[model samples]
Target: MSIKSVPLPDIGNFKDLPVIEVLVAAGDTVEAEQSLITLESDKATMEIPAPFAGTIQKVLLKVGDTVNVGDLIVEMSTQDNEATQKPAESAPAPAAAPTPPPVVDAPARSTTAEPASPPIPPTPPSTAAPVNAPTLGASAHASPSVRAFARTLGVDLSQIAGSGPKGRIQKSDVTAFVKQALTAPAHSAPATGGSIPPLPTIDFSQFGAIETIPLSRIQKRSGKHLSTCWLNIPHVTQFDETDITELEAFRQSLKARADKMGVKLTPLVFILKAVARALADFPRFNAALDASGENLILKKYIHIGVAVDTPNGLVVPVVQNVDQKGIFALAADLAALSARARDGKLTPEDMSGGCFSISSLGGIGGTQFTPIVNGPEVAILGVSRSKMSPVWNGSAFEPRLMLPLALSYDHRVIDGAEGARFITALSRSLADLRELIV
Candidate 1:
């Protein structure tokens, strides 16, 4: 019998699945029928099991992502099928270094350890493995992508040396390590010039009214990027209130049907659908201006960025081809992404390449606020909490579901007039509620 480790074919509805945890590491031995990872989508948690297990040698993806049916999940060699596979590594290194400290290979392994309030030096790999370190979860628990992510981040499950009952990796441990690694500087100590430990290149913080908090690597880079955006882009936030009574009614009508069909129907999902429909009529808003000082480069596709607020900070995860998905589908995807974002599970792919952004503070109590434009994108839409407000018809006033809208756009690409017009079109589309409903 020959075993060919293959990528898990992306098969199945991924609209609302949040990758819960990855169970295996690259190059780790896995048994047949073992679970690789666990996933929590819209309804329930599911696992991806190994059909023919041997050893995991590679991973192609990560957690905090949605997988459609037939997405490559893992590539492994079955124990009996080793002849067909590449030769194994001559000697397997001990799971952890002496002292047997938990391994830190990829940030993919699940751990529930909380972050140290004031950062301390991370334990070396030589520490003893905490017997109760982690739980040996099902094999299908982690997808190939998550395993790949851990590999990239250098997180090793074995080295983690389980601290949980039965040694299961928890979400907190993964979060803590990521927070620690990012905030800690990457550059090693500078070579001592002549003598002295490089004269202490990085100064330890001294006390003050403003306590110093070290920035994570991603945070530091993001700060520079945001500063650059602020410096260069001339941002103007235009606020408007839209009466979404009709839209809300329509949404309520379909939510039940969607749930029956096993799909989630969130408000942003409707908004995205509405926005996509409106963008076609208002092509000006859909297109991006030439940052090169030449002509406009209009993109045909709508890649909507869903602004997610995470413990780390605000991250915008892009939903590609938003124009192609329905409201229920969009909601499912957004829900999955949102959960991952809150859990600090999103990676670079999930946080980059957004053509336009939608920042919703509705979940948090707020009526209206200025949204910072995500640079390069010409515009960003902010959704405030929807509330009952008085509205005027041709002759009468009545209560309407009103949501305050804020659009922050780059003056270089969109003028004040064009921005207002775009808002008007969007508002009208939302009010009509027919374009997308049909």
Candidate 2:
């Protein structure tokens, strides 16, 4: 009996250390170094490596479990082939479909040879499975939320394919299935009574002249959390605008490589990079709150949040260890997170935890707006719109693109003067863009 151990690899981000899914189960056959389990840290997902050639004899962890470096993920039996079930071999080819007796309208046949690879064998279905009686109108097993999602998209999971845990329908899987069913050939009817519930009509009589639409699930939660942060934490505000000609030019120079990496080298992403850089010297800015009422809270890691505006609402997704990642990699992650935000797909975990926040409308070149500090974060940097404007060039006005930056900080933890100075440092960092790449 040869026993092989599966050790967890050093996944890059700490946030992703939570094990989301374990791919292989006991008695399951996995190739050497195949993905054994999946762990998500820092919103980035990575897979654990199989330690050796083996049969998975045991799985030590489950989903939502947290793990660390050098932890034992699983154990496997690395016995020789003869000691275990014989490896399945590719099957031989079936004879080409014989041409029907040549009809008058039959097309001509070619003499080309088929590939020599052997045919595959039919897979045996799982042995231990329960057979349930099918329901008529709809499945009672599905949750109300899942059913509502399916109804919203006009999806019938019975006709559409299911790509979810244990084949249970997921929201995304349902949405994709609906899209496929739309383009599919002559459709089959789903269990009858499948329809979208109508939206409730609004009643305006209860409120005064002005009434705002209620927030979404994500927005409502964000509002409550940020409100608590506002009440307990004393916040100070400071505003500054910088002429970022050099930063704008430098970003343009890296456009090709940035695009290839799927990184959007926006002035905002640059500002984030600088904020992280500056925090290295100013430990006071990179900290958390201790509303526990005894002592102030400080963090050892410098995670920064880049606030993203989506259809659902504003979400500030943190980029963990901003100082560790290069500008290009951070830019790529920013793009990926923005896509997640716009889709309203970010999980609760995505919106939590950050040392600092940066919000920017500079992509559209708007004047300036104060960005509320994401709760628990000490500072939020607001980036204004960048545009070609007149700047004094040796007494002559020259038209050049300049980015306006607005800096907002918590007054309780950070001083007004210090906040202004921090923004000043950020502006110099942006104007002196050379420091970023190195």
Candidate 3:
């Protein structure tokens, strides 16, 4: 038998992942593709698997040790095919044929092209078997991606109820869990104040009969997410009103063309285009804070999410590649996505990957309102009812269509000055269509 070393596989851009668990000990027999150790990063957890079957000669890593791709994991004593063949020399030539099958079967079982590699198990020995954490008391039924996401947030998967296939945990499940944790009310008192007493639970039944209607699933989920955004993010709302008098006239001019294209182009479409341009001018608004909270992830592609109000709750369907698509294309996408959202037909994919969000209450009656910043996204635009207001044009005062704009952004990522600049740029785009065209 000969000894062979197993090194960690490529984990992609992640450096210095800390070892969370060691599955095998020295002298323990392990099979090929079996998990040997688990590494956890800020965003996800991953496992190092055995390359080939062998008895572990030396376990090079332990829990809490930091590791990276290509780092040595274990020294394993594997069967030497040449040494095994030495015994075949004394036997008949026919024995050599059977010996080749074991060697062939060994490689075939361990290294199949399909499932090309082993599942990168992302838990330590205490939670061995990524699919089933027997040691953890109850199994967390979740997809690999969901598992990694849960670990990234340091959530206990066993505590969350799955709302997916066969009760499998989904990405939304992990997100919901984190949001709940962030928003869940604190039972403790304030650090500066004395212990505050809890509010008394009222029993209204003593006076009159009351009926309880539970909130819809969507409402409950959204409420938690909104609460998280409100408490965790330091939001600064930059309020400004844009003069859309000329822009509205231009949009009306295209009414016939828009109708011929089988789409109704509304003011929101023009606003979408303006937001995309502003994002291009200010790339920080198009970025998100990484899981570590130390790095910024600036997205090159611009996808905007439009908040739609449904009977069930609020849903944000994303319009992809806003920077690349024209107003007409955006009109079509918005029409399709909003209709689907209202009909409760919007899939999970329809609501993912939004660099920015817009919540417009213009159709209803609202002068101004604050909208929470969507998690993972740094900013959101709130649009309210437009009204005719007198504006001074340097020479005289004239009635102009003024649209209320509330720009809420993460104070950590954006400063008050940058916020002012973003809103100013957006206001300019609306005031002068030529600037947007240029």
Candidate 2's residue-wise lDDT over 1-438, tens digit each? 676666665443232255657888999988755777765432224555565567888898877555666667888887654233221221111111110011011011222332222222111122211111121113322334555554454444344334644455555555555444454454333321222123455777666586578765445445544544554456666777677787777889999988887667876677777888778767778885564534557777888877777665666666778889878888777887777767644543454567888877765557888676665567778888777888888989998767777776777678877887787887778878776556
> Could you arrange the candidates by TM-score from highest to lowest?
3, 1, 2
Q: Write the per-residue lDDT of candidate 3 for residues 132-178, one digit (tens) a residue.
A: 12112124565444555555555656667778766666667666666
**Colliding residue pairs in candidate 3:** none
- Order of quality (lDDT): 3, 1, 2
Total clashing pairs in model 1: 74
Off by over 4 Å in 3: 1-200, 206-209
Please give the range of 10 consecutive residues that has the lowest summed lDDT in model 3: 99-108
Tell me each candidate's TM-score: 0.55, 0.52, 0.58
For every model shown, the clashing-pair count is 74, 12, 0
For residues 1-438, could you state the per-residue lDDT of candidate 1 as single tens digits? 333654443323233244556778898887655667666432123556665557777765567654444455667766563433221211111110111011112123444333334332332233323222221111223433444444344454333433445544454444455556556544443322111121233544543345568864335444544544555568999999888888888778997898797877767887887778766666666666564545777778888888776555565667878888877778778887777666655533455456788989988979898877766667889999999987787799888989899998888788898889888878887888764556
Clashes of 2: 12
